[model samples]
Target: MREEAPRTVTAICRALQEQIECGLLPQGGKLPAERQLAEVFDTTRITLREALGQMEAQGLIYREDRRGWFVSPPRIAYNPLVRSHFHAMVGEQGRVPETEVLSARIVPTPAEMCARLELPALSSVIQIRRARRIDGRLVLYVEHYLNPQVFPGILDFDLTRSLTDLYASHYDIRYGRVAFDMVPTALPAEAASILKVTAGSPALLITRVNRDQHGRVIDCDVEYWRHDAIHVSVEVPD
Candidate 1:
């Protein structure tokens, strides 16, 4: 018989991250006690503490003095292009909006993403690819990168649901400032498949990054809007 290698805290954290993202553990809920978690993972309490510490730093869980650790709520959505929720945009047109969370995971931030986030060095980012629809017709494709350390359980929430409401109700995030950059581009191969469009089709590529009240980077995203489908009319504040 072969002996198994002892589990480390990093491994435990990754497992927990995966579970949270997959909804195995519900959001805003308490995590298992240290003793129980250690036993479950076949690890030591010290290692479990280390793993929990990393998660705490990432805003995934908070430890009460007497109580145990609990998962943090989901983050809010603030569009730099306009002062509106994607849901609100569809609602105004007398259309219902639906979202399909295509893909999501935790990975090292790419160079471009690091620059947008203004992160010092390489950092972990939460990657989310989703499609937005109006009247059951696909209209918008979004790729969002959030600071994994700042928005824990990001993978756990039902992303088909509205993230904007989740941020406000769970984390008390009010609103965010907006900045946008737009470009004309041909649709990439992968994006075309999900958007149900032909490759190299004309599209509007808009990049945006959101900041909180304290000026912390909350989220950065790129949106691909089909040129033939929808155009926007904006109203400025008085």
Candidate 2:
């Protein structure tokens, strides 16, 4: 028999990645049985398990105790700068939260975005595009990016629903610390279209990052506030 090159976990992950790329495995689909994979690769059970573990780490799959691994879903988003929930934010000034999800997908993070999030190159990221309205009047257009591995099934969530509550109840993510910075600018054509405002209208671009009890970054969100509608509250540091 020809000498067989030792199979490694990286090789296993690469094999699965290729399968996914070729559509042999579709999104939201379960992975093969561990034993079947082990047999196909002609590898020891331990080596097969190592491969599975690597895949899980890369957000390709998720495993439940006593249950097998399944393909992992995308991540959800919430801003940490403001102490208000999504519902509360919309409800401010007695406005109803009306939201429409424009798009949700997984993509390789761009260099600019990766730098902001401090993520590695080519890491998988979930992007959410949405429009928010108050009293049936559009006021904000948002593009959210999240790390899918941390908060799975985020894309399946009701986009109009309160993401903050969902994270707290489902994922045990409660942001204990929040910080934000703001910059003033004229609304671009794209943002104006969704907000139903004229181009060059004044706007506030707010950047926020939040940390959980364990000091892990739970959420990082950028908010676009209509100039006429938003108010700033601050305390100056000595």
Candidate 3:
């Protein structure tokens, strides 16, 4: 006998939840197609979709446009005090990290940016935008603003590689004291589009100011990360 709509939805949700809990559907694994999943659950497409929607709301799954749903991966641990860059941190967890440079240019520093970097009025800053991924999933988008006077000719270098390494190698400027500010917010449109997530999705906004040994500001970084994609952790002394 065909079950009632409510009962059918509940049963399907329970079954899929069990699959995830029991590791039958591993983290980061793609869920079966909608048609296949519906047939296996012996439910109508609408019911199956309802079940999937429940899972997505619970952060058990996520969808990419033009791509099917995937089980959510465990969040990456991020320590604000750690000096490691994104690549090292992701690699330490055995996940592949990739970066794509979206744009690099010299633009007049905005008022707020000038204050953040302590730049003089009418200063020009080198801005670089990048998308960072882990295991082929977009996790972070960043905008880097560099002091042009400190890093002359920086725009001529290959911007796709790690900026940390570039700073050390090309300019002998290693990271010194750093400051971090984090906030919970909704993803902006450009970030949402690049990350393949809907606008207004929950996210973390992290702002970092990097300095050199001489206490001179090197650059400031603004990073936006999916709320479900990272876990921030830090150890504080008693």
Which candidate number would show the highest TM-score if scored against the true structure?
Answer: 3
Q: What TM-scores do the predictions have?
A: 0.63, 0.60, 0.86
Q: Which run of 10 residues does model 3 get worst, by summed lDDT?
A: 1-10
In candidate 1, the residue pairs with backbone N, CA or C atoms under 3 Å apart (3 or more residues apart, or in different chains) clash, namely 21-155
After the best TM-score superposition of candidate 2, give how far the Cα of residue 22 lies from its true spot, in angstroms.
Answer: 66
Q: Candidate 1 versus the native: TM-score?
A: 0.63
Q: Report the C-alpha lDDT of model 2 over 1-238, residue by residue, as the tens digit.
A: 1233234666888988898777788755777788888899888788888777677556566454345666544322334445677568656546566778878889888776687666889887788777776554445677777767768998887866767787788888887777676798777888876675557656678776666777766556767755544456545558
* lDDT at position 47, candidate 2: 82
Off by over 4 Å in 2: 1-82, 234-238
lDDT of each: 0.74, 0.68, 0.90
Q: Decide which is better by lDDT, 1 or 3.
A: 3
Question: For model 1, what is the alpha-carbon lDDT of residue 90?
Answer: 68
- Candidate 3: Cα lDDT at 73: 95
Q: Look at candidate 3 and give me any clashing residue pairs.
A: none
- Full ranking by TM-score: 3, 1, 2
Instruction: State the lDDT of candidate 1 residue by residue for 1-238, as single tens digits.
Output: 0132234766888899998898887776789888999899887777788788778656566454456776655432333446667888667666677898989999888899998887757788989999987666565799998887677886888877776777777667645676688787877987776777567756679888887767778888898875544555555678
Is candidate 2 or 3 superior in TM-score? 3
Model 3 scores a TM of 0.86
